[model samples]
Target: MSSDEEWSSGEDDSQPSKLVRKAREAPFVPIGLAGCLTLVAYGLYKIKDRGNQKLSVHLIHMRVAAQGFVVGAITIGVLYSMYTDYVNPTSSKPKK
Candidate 1:
């Protein structure tokens, strides 16, 4: 008779978690998030070094920079999706 440990070991434990699978499937999302975070951090650093500019102006520019980066990332993700779907789909249906 197989021991409990042996039976359990036979089970497939190598499958990745849902989060890991999703991350692998849509890697751009995490990349975009990281880029947004980096931009925000840089903005904060610049704000600390603000010499003569008003706080409001610095804040506005920072906001624009962060938002612009996120927008660009989203656009790239969309374009990539479109290309994969239309130009080179991974799974195509068989013809009748």
Candidate 2:
């Protein structure tokens, strides 16, 4: 009998076992990159609105808005990273 036929004919439990094994092995690089990108974008947006400021009050308002945007972006990034890493680690990495 052919090797493929022999392997497929067996009523083994290795399929589920292999899936379980793979579920335990994954990387977190993408999660980290996503977080860093979010922070960088926030920083850029926060700093890019400081042009042609005619009054101190306007400048202060801009600064406060910028800070809020940055903080919100960072918080979202961190929460997403943690969720992806802990709640669904298997989908975080691709199979090689």
Candidate 3:
């Protein structure tokens, strides 16, 4: 094969390609942080509000807050998954 073709095909140039792959695989930090913060705030608010209510009302709020937290967590998971699978296409697999 021609030298130019060999070089362009990248068989001997693995390091840069590996670096590029690593960069692409990097996790998005900001969105993940936001999601975590949102979940924490929701939990705290639920706790604080629970102390100010009748038992029935408090239970209702707690239920709603639990749902919110779950949704937020799932949203973050889905977004990270999407970023890895489609947007970045090189990110590491999510930890089990």
* Model 2, span 13-90: residue lDDT tens: 488865554444422333444455665566456565757754575656655655555566657766777887899888
Question: Positional deviation of 60 in candidate 1, in angstroms?
Answer: 1.6
Candidate 2 structure lDDT: 0.58
Which rank order by TM-score, best down to worst?
Answer: 1, 3, 2
Taking the tens digit of each residue's C-alpha lDDT, what string does model 3 give over 1-96?
Answer: 766553356685599887666545543343444555665576566665565567677656655765665666567767878786788875554656
Predicted structure 2, TM vs. truth: 0.42
Task: After superposing candidate 2 on the true structure, give the runs of residues whose Cα lies further than 4 Å from its correct spot.
Answer: 1-54
Pick the TM-score winner.
1
Q: Against the unseen true structure, what C-alpha lDDT does each candidate score?
A: 0.77, 0.58, 0.61
Over 4 Å off, model 3: 1-52, 93-96
Instruction: Give the better candidate number (1 or 2) by lDDT.
Output: 1
The residue pairs in collision within model 1 are: none
Write candidate 1's Cα lDDT for 13-85 as tens digits. 4556655767777777777778888988998888878999999998888888878887888789888888878
lDDT of 1: 0.77
Q: What lDDT would candidate 3 get against the real structure?
A: 0.61
Model 1 root-mean-square deviation: 8.2
Candidate 1 residue-pair clash tally = 0
